[model samples]
Target: MSTNAAFRLQDAGFSRAQVEALGEFLDSQAATKTDLIEAKTELKAEIAEVKTELKAGIAAVRTELKAEIAEAKADIIKWMFGTIVAQTALIIAAVKLLH
Candidate 1:
């Protein structure tokens, strides 16, 4: 049985085959790096889109809460005014009768 040994540039001296193989390896690595960079760029764009959506959601919630708070405050004011008016009228009638 015969076995073919792999050639090393250092052991065999510089040859056209060695240089071509190195070039191919370098090209493959470059292609892989380019793919990774493109993927990272796409991810960043997606993240930006998600952040924009989140901000809009938060703003909508704040606006709704503000409206609810204003309604609650108005109801409280109306209740307070009605109570005061009724109490004052009763007190005036009682004083008038005693006199």
Candidate 2:
């Protein structure tokens, strides 16, 4: 507390001793600049750790999705080829019967 504040408190009916004790108590309970900085640093570290874990998880999921998509594409190609061959055989048999 500044001298001005102490003087104001005295004018407002607070004793010198009372004002001094109040200032001391308030200061003790308040957080310092260093305390806030330390808390901020710790929070940043925790956030970075979480971010790294998320990135690794996303990469693993991406790999799995790619594998699944490739397998699906292979199955589709096989089915398409089989359908085309079967269609061609039916068309040829129909033309011979019609003649």
Candidate 3:
């Protein structure tokens, strides 16, 4: 608090002891401008770090999903080829019977 302000408070029906107590209360409860700025900077840095980690995690999941999808596609293709061969062999046997 400034000298003028302190005097003003005293003139406005505040006791000197009351003004001193008010100053102490405000000092204890309020952060300085420098303290607030530093806190904001630290919070921003932590947020940026979390964002980087989250991106890495998402990319890893995407890669795993792609690999799984490729494996499933290969399994489906193998099953299809097996079914085709089986059907062709059955047709050949039926034709031989007719002959």
Leading candidate by lDDT: 2
How well is each residue in 6-47 modelled by candidate 2, as lDDT tens digits? 899999999989999988998898899999999999999999
- Reference-based lDDT, each prediction: 0.81, 0.96, 0.95
Model 2 gets an lDDT of 0.96
Ranking by lDDT: 2, 3, 1
- Residues 30-65 of candidate 1: C-alpha lDDT, one tens digit per residue: 757779899999999999999999999999999999
lDDT of 1: 0.81
Off by over 4 Å in 1: 1-31
Off by over 4 Å in 3: 1-15
Residue-wise C-alpha lDDT for candidate 3, range 12-92, written one tens digit per residue: 999999999988887788998999999999999999999999999999999999999999999999999999999999999
How close is every model to the real structure, measured as TM-score?
A: 0.60, 0.80, 0.74
Q: Which of candidates 2 and 3 reaches a greater TM-score?
A: 2
